[model samples]
Structure formats: C-alpha cells, structure tokens
Target: MAKRAFDQASQNQPTDEARDAYLEASRAGQSQPPETEAPAAPEVEGQETSEALQKQPTEAEDDQQKLQLEPEKDQTEQQQKLQEETDKEHPEAEGETAAPEEPETEPVDFSILKNGTVNKGGNVVNEDGKAVGRVTEGILKHLIGKKVDEKGNIWSTDGKIVGKAEPVSESERDELLKEPAPFESFPDAVVDKDGFVVSNGEQVGKVIQGDLAILRGKSVDPDGDILDKAGNVVGKAVRWEPEPEPEPEPEVPVDKSILAGKRVNKAGNVVDGSGVIFGRVVEGDVKRMVGRMCDKNGNILSESGDILGKAELVPEGEREGLKEGPFAELEGCTVAKDGTVVTPAGDIVGRVIKGDAKILFGRAVDEDGDILDKNGNVLGKAERWEPEAVERKKNPMSGRKVNREGNVVDEDGNIIGKLTSGDLQKCSGKEIDDDGDVVDYKGNVVGHCSLIEDIPKVEEESPEDKEKREQAEQDKKLAIQMSVCIEQCLDKIRPICKMITEKIDKAERTPEDERDEEALVREVKPLIEEGGRILSEAKGIIKGLDPDGRIAANAKHKSAAREATPEEHHLADVLKDLTGDVTQCIDNAKRKLEDMPHAKKELNPLWGLLNEPLFQILAAVGLLLAGVLNLVGRLLAGLGLGGLVDGLLGTLGISRVLEGLGLGSFTKSLKGGKKKGGGLLGGVLGG
Candidate 1:
C-alpha cells in the first residue's frame, strides 16, 4: 500500500509540483498556469533555485544514487538470512525463497516493489533491498495513522519504516484529542451515525465519500477546503455542514390577561417597570392598558438600552414559546415575563422574568394608576382603584385614596366620583350645578361623564326623572327667594302705611295687578327724586365722602386730561362738576332773596297768582321743583345730553336737583323701581 501510494503521488507529481510552483510564484509576484500530470511515479519535483539548476549536480547525484542501488555483498547476505527466517515461519508457502547461504558477486537491488508484495505481513520491499511501506489512502492520511517509535521514525502496522516524524507528548496527545480531528485523520470510532465526525459527544462535522469534506467551523473557501477550529488545512473540503440553525430558542410563556386588552403607546411600545415608556402611544386608547409608553417621535423612554431594548410590559401569553437571545425574538405583538404592561381595564401589572414587550398593543399606563398618552394627556376616565372618602394619609400612593365603593376627592378638595384633568369629574349622588361641568383651561367644556345613584325603593318613573328633579329644585329655590323678598318689603313698608292712611279722607281700591304702574311710579317718583337730591346735597356737604374717592376723582380728571380711553369715572366727574355749579346757583338764589326783602311782596302775589305760596313756601316749592329738575337733568346727562339747556340748568341749581332726582330714577327705572323707592324713602324718613 505504501508503494502504491508513492507511485500515485509520483504520477501526479507534475500537477503537485505545478500547484506548489504557482503558489511559490504568486508569493514572488509571478503568474503561472497550473500543471497537469499523471497520478503515479514518485520524484522530488519542485522549482529549484537558479544555482541549483545550473549545477545539475542534484540530478547527477540522483543518477549516481540510482546506480548505487546495489547493496554490498554482506548486506545481501544478511537479507538472504532474513528471507530464510521468514520462510521458516511459513514453510508451506508457494514460491518460497530459501536463498543460498552465500554472497553473490552481483549485489542485489532491494528497493523495487510490486503490487501485493509482502515481506512479513503487508510490508512491501523494493528491488534496492529497502522496505518501502504499506499502501493507504494517501501520504498525509497514512502518516497520521502511523505510530512513531522512540527513534522518531514512523512505522507502518506491518513494521515497514518511513522518515522520522515529529515527536508529541502525552499532553500533546490530549490536546490533539480535544482539538477537532482533521477530516482525513478521523478514526473509525470518531464518526457518528450520520457519518459525521463526533467529538465530545457532539458531531464535530461530516466527511463525504468523494472529494468533498466538511470540518468543524462553518466556513468554506474558494478552494473548497473547510477550515477547522485551528484554521488549518484539514481536508479536501466541500461546503461546511450547514449548522442546523439552532432550534429557535423556545419562546417564554406569557400571561393570557396581558393579551386580553394589551395596550401600547403611539410608537407601539409598552411600559416598563419604571413606568418609563418604550413606544409611541396614540390618543384615545386606554393608557393604563398599555404596558409601555413612547413619545410621538418614536423615542423609547425606558430603562432599557438601545439596539437591544428590554421590552416594557407586554400582554401575558404573547411571548408564548419564544426563547431568549438578542436576535432570537422578533417584534411580535407578544408580552414576555418581566415586562411591564397595562391591562384592558387600565390595571398596570409588571412583567415576570423571561418576558417580552410584544404582548402589548396600544396606549400606556403609569405607576400612579393613571392612563396617559404619548402627548401626556390623561387617558380615558381616571378611575380610582378605590373610593375617594378613605383616609388618604395611610396609603398616600395607593392610587385610590378612598374605599372601593366610596366617594373620591379631587386635587381641588372637591368630593368627586372620578377625578380627571386636575378637576372633579363626578360626585356620586350629587346634583350637577352650572359649575359641575368639566372644562379645559380655556373654560370650554370638552366632554362629560355622568354619575347616578340608584335610590332603593324609590323607583324612577322614567328616564325623565332628571328633568323633573332639576325643575322641582329650581322652582323650590325661586319660591323661597320670592317669600323672603315679600316678607322684607312688608316689614319695611308696614309703618309707612299708617302715616299715609290718616292723611286720606277716602281711599279707592284697585286690584293689585290692575293698579296704574305709572301712578305708582308718580307717587314714588317724588320721594325717589327727593332722596336723590338729599343724597347729592349731603355729598356736597360732606366735602369728600372718602379720601380714596377724591384721589380716584382726581385720577380720573388726570386720565381725561391725558385723553385715555373713555371711563365711567370721567363721565361721573363731569356730572359731579355740573352738580357743584347747580348747587352754587341755588345758594346764590337763596342769598338774593335774603338780600331783597321787598321782592317777597311781589314774589308772594306771584306765588298766589301761580297758585302756590311764596318765600318759605317757595323755598319748599323750590325744593320739590329742584328734585324734579335734578332727576330730569341727570337722566339727560346720563343719556349723554350735551346741549345749551343742559349747560343752563347745570349753571342753575336745578341741574343738581335734576341729577339727584334723575340719578336714582334712571337707576330705579333700570332696576324696575317699584319697591326701592317705597322701601328707601320709608327707611330714610322713618329712621
């Protein structure tokens, strides 16, 4: 076998040499064609250096060595003795050679070997008296199988020897055993049932029956050689055994509740344990149901890292049967254990170990038990886990401050059913007033949720009970208000009735509603006008009613001088000045009467002609006239009257009287004046 292997290598020597030469040439920056040669005939074939080529001595030495194949006589004699010893062991063998026990003049060559030749077992001998070796698969394989003696020479199983091989220690032997065996060096025991090389109980790689081979590492080169762990030439390799893709990591089990109403954020992320978000959460979805949250820009705001983010909570059972690894899991809509997530009912439950974020679907909830959007809007109704009336101090962070079935308190300390947006949403069993509606910061009502209490035993007649209840409430309120007002007016006017009753000789009765409203006005008008005048006169007497008033009035005048926006105070000042002018004129008229006593005689007859008293009577008469004029003047002035008659009356005392009278009339007229004049006049005069 050794001789045959040598012959085959020698025949393919030219090709081998060419491959080697091309490799060498490439290293030298040269290009050369690959050579084809026969598969047998051994020779030392290679590119020789120019010096070695020019000498031609190596060839001459080869020829001389060929001629020297004949061994000495003594060596031939020793071979014959060995042949006899071999024949003695197998005496009945045909063509057995029992060589003559004498030296021949022509020395015999022993290096020649024939097919099936054998010396003892399968060891082959050449004609040059050399034991060549046994034949095997190839030189490399055979060399690997051969055992080396203490002298470092490799000996075949048949005792044929070859060149010395490198020595290895027992430690080296263990290391080689640990290292994956080369494809060609595989022992029969090394193969598995699949014909793959097994090492340490695992199939290291496979070997093909033909030229193709696959080694340990899953790498293939252009030359079809598979590399082993050490990156050495292991075999005439084919494509690497495709590593059976690791059985997809078994997926982790997820909870079923997580999937029931899994919520995610706008970016479709779930919430993490820290209440940080991992995905975008859109609006309207229950934020509490989302395990994770994200901003609109797809920025995950969780404790996890980039590229390999730890999924927040996902729906339970969503990661069913998934394994763990960076790339092992895809972004399936499944939740894993240890992931944080929210439930459909807005319960925020944390994930268990071995969980993922895929379990959640939309919107995210926070640890505060509030459902929030990516845009930070509170999601859905802010349902408290418990009632609002409980002691808040005990479980300050317990999302529900009250017991499960009690009232809830909002941030504003209002007892609400469920609070939202920093305000009270509902107060159980309480009626909604005008201020009960929920509104945005701009005071616009956004939406509403209703609260109703089932009144046991008191069945509602229909759904219209709300309207009935509301109307009944309003009517009760108005009735109470009307009773109080009527009682107050009666209390105030009772005394005045006695005074007016004795003055009348007879009285005509009229239905309360049919009585002339204008006559009622006329009867009260004089008093209102008189009261207004008195008030004006008192104001003038007081110098300044309040220090702030004078300062305020001055400020108004200054403002008018600056021509700022038209103000009520500015108009009031102009009226006040006219009143002052009117008051001065009235004082001057009084003084003129006192200065001219003779004029009273003329005035007295003039008064009689006029069907009124003069002097003291005229003063009283002037008082009434001033009251009427003051009212008319104030009315016209207030109506923005700016005419010569207004200016003249303002210069006279009548303008003050008019203002006093008209100020109250216009106010009373504006106020539907029925009770005010009657009550106020009686209060002042009676007091």
Candidate 2:
C-alpha cells in the first residue's frame, strides 16, 4: 500500500524533470517560501488481498522489496540532480539571465518615438546623441531580448536619448556614460529656475552650460546668471560701440593785402611782422624819393606812411658842377650851422659888401625904399632890370679917382673921368695914352695915355721858359716809363703774392699741435728775400733823383717854352707830371721792400745781385729821371689829372709782389704812402 501511494505521488508530479525537481526541493526546505501548491490524490476502491503483495514475513521477500525500492529512489534522485544542474547552466531558459540586459536603457526621451510607433522625429541617436538613421546590431546586441518599442527605441529615466536599445560599440557605450546625467534633478517645466526656457516636449538636445542665445537681436541668458567658462557672471548681450572718430585739423588764415607793411619773400608771398618796404629809387627817377619809403606802385600805402623820410634832390642843371663846392657835396651831406667859410680865395662865406648900383632889367628898390639916384634925380621904376657892378675910377690926368656914388672926383675940369648915369650909377676907366691923351669907351683919344707899350706881352716865350719846357717834357717821358714798369711789376707779382699770403694764413690758422714752424719759415724765406731785394732796388733808384723830383718841375718854365704853341705846352706838362708820379712810386717800392724781414736778414743771394754797384749806378740814372717824373706828377695832379699815381701804385709790383715774398709789413708800409708821401724820400722812407 505505501509503495503504491509513493508511485502515485511521483506520477502526479511534472513530466518535466526540472519541474519535478523543483517540487522535491520545495518539499525538502520548510524554511523556504512554499514553492508549489499542495497536490490532491484521487481515492481508489480496493478489493483485495493478494497475500503475496501484503504479507511481510519471509527474509527473502523483505530483501527483494528493499532492492526494488533502492533502485527506484536512486533513479528519482539522479533525475532531480540533473534537472537542477540544467536550470543553473541555462539561466535564460529559466527566465533569470541578467533579465535580457534591460534593453540597454537610454534616457527616457519619448520624443524619439511617435505615440506607439517610431516616426521621423523619432530618428535614432548614436551613443553621443548625434542623430543616426537606425539602431545597429553593434548597439542592439547589448540589449538582446529586452523590451523595446516596435521602432527599437529605448528610454531612460532622465527623459533623454542617451543611446539606442541595440548592440553598440564598447566605445559608444563609454561615450554614452560620459554624457552628463539629465538635469532631472530639477523639473520638466519649460521655464528654468532663472527665467522662461522653451524646450521641445521631446528631448532637449545637447545643452552646453555657457553658450548664449538671442531673440530679436537681443541676447538672452536663460540661466539668469549666465556664467562664463570660468563661472563668472557676464552681462546680457549688447550692441557694439562704434570705432572712435578722428579729429580734424584747423585752417591757416590767408593774407590778402600785398603791401600790408610786410615784406614778400622770394616765393612772392607776403608774411606777417616784417618791416615796411622801400621801392626802387634810381637816379633821375625822383631825387626826393632817394631815401623815402614807397609801396609797389598800384598798392595802397601803409597806415604809418607819409613817405618814411625826406629826400635830397640833385637837379639836372646842378649836375655839371656837382663834383665841386656845395654841389660836389654828397646828396645827404649836411652843412654845419657855423658854415664852411674858409675857401681858397678868402673867408667870404658870411661877409656882405655894397657895390655901384645899376639896374639893367630887374625890379629894384633904393636904400630909402624908393627908386632914385644920389643926385636926387628920379630913376624909372622897373619890373626887371640888370644891376650894376661897383668900380673905382681914376682920372689919369689929375691922379684923382671917384667913389662908386660919383661923389669923390678930381677937381680937374679937364674931364679926368665921369660917372655914368643909369637906373644905377657906375664909373668908367680913366686912360692916359703915350701922347698924354685919354681914350674914351668908343676908342677915341679923349685924353693922352702914358707909356702903354712899356707893359709886358704875356704871349711871348722867354729864355728861362724855353729851358724849363724842355726839362718838363723829359720828366714826363720818364714818368710814363716808370708807370709801365710798376704796372708790369704788379701783374707779375700779384698771383705769387696771393699764394704766399694764403700759405702764411694757413700756417697761422692751423692748430698749435699741427703747426710746422720750421717748414713754413724755410718755405717762405727765399720769397721774402726776393721781395726785399726788389724793394731795396726801387728805393735806391728813387734816392738818386733830385729832392723835389720831376713832380716839382717849374710850370712857368714849361709854359714859356710852349708859347710857340699851346698844344706843345699841354703835352709837355702831361709828360712832366707822369715822370714825377713814376719817380715817387719807385721810391715807395724801395722803402717798403728794404724794411721787410728778408731784406734786413740778407738771406737771399738774389738780393746781393739786386744790390750790385752797377745796378745801383743804373738805378741812380733812373733816380735822376725819377726826380723829373716826380715834379711832372705834381704838376699833372694840380692840373686835374693826378690819378696817374693810383694807376702806378696798382701797376707796381713793389707792394703786391712783396706780399708773395713774405713781406706783409712792407706791403702795409707801401699802402700807407698816400698819407706820408708829400715828398719823394719822405714818402718812401715813411712807408
């Protein structure tokens, strides 16, 4: 009976060995929760007594039954063990292996699905949230049998499309993990904590923390604080400021007036602050305008102008005598209040004298302010008349003379002389001829004139005149020759003198450290000697001449000799004057040269040659002629032709030539001759 019951229980268990093992396991652990419901066994009607099956007596029967039970129990335990082992080995079949990987959950973003089906908006996303066409095996395999929408979309708690519910690369999976956890800590409301935010009902795609948004050109900061990358608050967006504008430069004022008291520069434009202008004032333009101020002809005069200064005019009629006396005075020369009274004739600058009166054709008035004669006779009044010159007259017969008023006369009624009558009274000459007859104004013999032939005839030449004339001519020729020599000398010597002078100047100008005194001296020594010799020679020549020289030759002698012809006298005078000038020049040169250092030191052998007795004798001959020339020069200068001396000085090599010879002192002395050369030797020696 027990064996039948056990067989029945086992049969009522599952055909699946695993289910049956579970039932047995359930039964074995009472501490465990009830794993299976209790089973109900159907009751069976028994009619029997098979003594063989029921009886328990014999040892063989007991042993046989025990063997049968052991085999059956062993079979059942083996089947149950195999079943449990299979369940563990194949947990998927048991509905327990990792729960099908949970479909590789993504953030629950329903926007990736369209209601119950996937739509265009439900496009799948890669693990990085970049939109993709569909879920790949690489992504799907990770979510093997997990629940997924029909479109294979997966969702996560954060409502974001983190990844698709499919097999994805391990790298993709890692990328998904790195994404920020959803902002779900807050809420799904469109408005954020700071202000309003518009989010799609679906997913809010990648939202970076710092990017700015704008609406209607105005920057919007939904996060309110709008923190920068460094987490510092930045203000809302604003319009940019325009670049700073550049400044403009000021303008310069222009001057419009041409003669606005300013001078125009070479560029022809007027500048401010310059002094006034004085226009061209050439001779003959306007004499008074010489020093006066004027603007350009057409321009307006300056406010300060009335013509700046007074002008002195030299009229055309006065030009001829301009070189003499008051006329010769400079245009602006001023006369002293005391006056220039000392003249060649006498000091007549302020003296007054009365003279016999006659009126030829002039308006005249008498001493009493009436027109009358001393005899109480009425003289005719005149608008114009000639005035008479006063004179003293004598009667040759009585030795008596009458005064200018005809008051004093010889008592002789013999008619010695009569005072002529006119608007003014005057006296006529009383003459007595050899016959004791006086000649009247008509050439008639009114009275006898005495010894008229006894007077000298100034037109005839005298013996003394003849001699002086010849000498003057000789003097003049000598002067000409001397002048030629001087000129030639100056021409030859000027350049060399300039060179020497420049060299000396250079040496003097050089710094002390750079100076070479010995070299400079040696170089100049010979030149100095040459100049000295020339000067000494010239001096020697001058000394041989007479004291006054040709310049003092007797003009009377020359004039007398020339009485035969006027032209001859003029020529002789000129020649004599020229000779005197040459003589003086030679002396000047000599004195200047001898005084030079080189000549004094006697360093030049050439100087000895110049000093030779023969040369001296020859020079002596020239001196004799030079003396004559000197006299001639004086005569010529007195005759208004003295410039010959200047010509000679310039021509003479003496002074200028000496310059090259290192005779600067000698040159200076020669130049000084103008003041000292009153006499031949005086000029030379003084120089």
- Give the alpha-carbon lDDT of every model: 0.33, 0.36
Candidate 1 has a TM-score of 0.15
* Steric collisions counted per model: 90, 63
Task: For model 1, give the RMSD to the true fold.
Answer: 29.7
Q: Which ten residues in a row have the lowest lDDT in candidate 2?
A: 34-43
Q: Which digits, one per residue and each the tens of the lDDT, describe model 1 over residues 619-661?
A: 2211221222223334434543323233333233332433443
| lDDT of prediction 1 | 0.33
Query: Over all chains combined, what TM-score does candidate 2 have?
Result: 0.19
Give the number of the best model, judged by lDDT. 2
**Lowest-lDDT window of 10 residues in candidate 1?**
609-618
Taking all chains together, each candidate's TM-score versus the true structure is: 0.15, 0.19
